[model samples]
Target: MFSSDILEATVTIIPLWDSVAYITMKAVILDGEWDPRPEYECSETEADTHKSNNGSQTWKHPALHIENREKPTPESDEVLVKVRYTGVCGSDISMTHADGDRYMHYSAYVNLPNVIGHEFSGEVVETGEDVQSFSKGDLVTSEVTSYCGRCHMCRNGFNGHCENFEQLGFTIPGAFAEYVAVPEILLWDVSPLEKAYKSKDDILKAAATIEPTTITYNGLFGRAEGIRPGDYYAFHGVGPIGLTGMNVARAAGAGAVIAFEPSDERRDLARELGFEYVFNPVETDPTQAVAQVTDGMGVDVHVETAGAVAQTYPAIDETLAETANVVHISNAGEPASVDLRQYQANAAQVYGAEGHTGDRIFTGVIRLMAAGKLDNLPLVTSIFDLEEADTAIEQASKRVDGKVLIEV
Candidate 1:
């Protein structure tokens, strides 16, 4: 029996008083269309108010301090998530020390004291009243980029490149906290994992790898000559994404997956994972090694996932068959200088790829895990709690092999 005006009044102060007397009384008057005094209008809960006023964590500005702020409140078009796990990305390492964030400058809500970690998975604790697609307690992950939806790119279904896009872990508040507020559209339920893995933990581990895997997927499938079963692909870099790409390319039906890596540990993983040839590009000429393996003909597809500056143009030369597609999946910031003279003679194509929604590839990885085609357990090198975030970052700086996970 609540009237619209009264309901609004009650909502205005719900965050302050948690008791039934105040709430019910407010609801009663709201039912009668009586507006509450402006002085009594508590817009945010004490927790949220504290956070807004005082920087919450010790790191304060960029790093979150939960003691200062309350768990986030969901907006009408947003959902509140209880973060379960968050993955540390290579970009995070660079951003922590970089003088500038190139992508955040392109967003609408790039503000300071921002929460900054994008690779995550969580459970839906609450939803805004206007939200209808999801309910409480749904397990989900999301497309980290937040788009304005009305923009040209978004209208055309390429939300990833929306003019007013706001990305998590960079511009806006992210999943590093105990709770995070995310747009409903960006949130995706990973509940399907229950049927896909031995347990949800397996999926969470797999989830940590999704962002990088999507980068590889988009690089290979989104724009390329096209991938067919039994195509030979040469992959540069055998880190997590490269390793994942090795399997993804194989799963997509590559006849042979050749890997180039300097780390002996990673090289072994590549061999164990079924890569046809593992080359120590640091010891021998990667181009020569790849050429030797392919009998001088060249592979059908070449993927540059390694950010190694030295491997840039050579990766192009090594992977491009007469009519091959050379895709660069990793972000190597240095300006690439190539002699234009070679362009006329080399019969090949080149493409640059970046961030992804990741759900499609994530689903594929899960399916691979379910079918026993891929193993998620072996990928994790270490796990840390939220309080150990700094320590985890410090450890990751050492470049220990495999993935580093933050167990929230």
Candidate 2:
């Protein structure tokens, strides 16, 4: 499942010594507490640690670093994955950021002091006795949202909303380290990518990207009814999610895909990816630009990856075509006012999208990558070693680059 070169670099299996293995793998960890804030209201679904309402607006990571971590052991139905590469997602950056008082800027469905990462790819090194689907040497990438297949939501065909939820990298030990134990059911085969990519590193990079692309897939197609052939669409941000969505939207037969971003680096990267219509949202009114192109007909799909709702939604309001599908995949903790009457005026609909647990989200994306329709590896502009995971997340927080990866 892994090249010999990678095995030496990622896997460090030391001789078991007593009850404590003095030599452990390295990982990026984020620690936080359940201190509540007056402005915040606790949710019944709030993580076990933060179900009370007395902390700040968000939980901050007081301690985040690359530290020694014990390797994981797979459960009866799980497989131990030797993570080769892990992408530094926006949520990782958010969880790692904190003010002088340790107040976080982003927090929802977050519980920490665990390894901080969800987007990853790896080779199966060990499988439990009861694990039937996967085996040693299997190349795989698992879902960020771990869903119990037998849950009510899963049985009802909404596996993404499974009640027994524990988000990898958020509420549990994640793939930032040398290994992760994931149930076989959630794992997706990425071996086909090995044939498509030129090298083992390249294959892992592409596989590490699968999670994000599938997320955009779920948000656009699964959650928002996708786009119609020749339907005009626009992405409000050109971050990882937006970049992948633009390509996915095009592959789904979008007539034109436009990108609106404030980052110059990201905008240029979008253009480099063959997206002809790229604009800096700060300098250009996307609504006006899109209006000029569409001749006031507007776009059939408007994707919101720009977490700045106050800034992006106004443009979405004016640029929404009739029966448009407005999908919110970005997480912005603060609320922004919206002109909801537009839905009625335009006969459009809005979708609250998150999680990539079902809807063939992983299958579609992996197939697209294998078919050469999606090249997310180019989206990774920066790379850092696993021991420098903190630096990787810091770089991601700048928002000046595309996907930032931590190669283990």
**Cα miss at 385, model 2 (Å)?**
0.5
TM-scores of all predicted structures? 0.77, 0.89
Q: Clashes in model 2: which pairs?
A: 35-55, 36-54, 36-55, 36-56, 37-54, 37-55
lDDT of 2 by residue, 185-283 (tens): 889989888657888778888999889888778888788874689999889988988998888988888888989998999999999888888998889
Candidate 2: segments with Cα more than 4 A from true spot: 1-23, 38-61
lDDT of 1 by residue, 267-380 (tens): 876776667688887787867776777778777788887777565575556446666777877767566655444444566777887667533655665566556666545767
lDDT (C-alpha) at residue 386 in model 2 = 87
Question: Quick one: best lDDT, which candidate?
Answer: 2
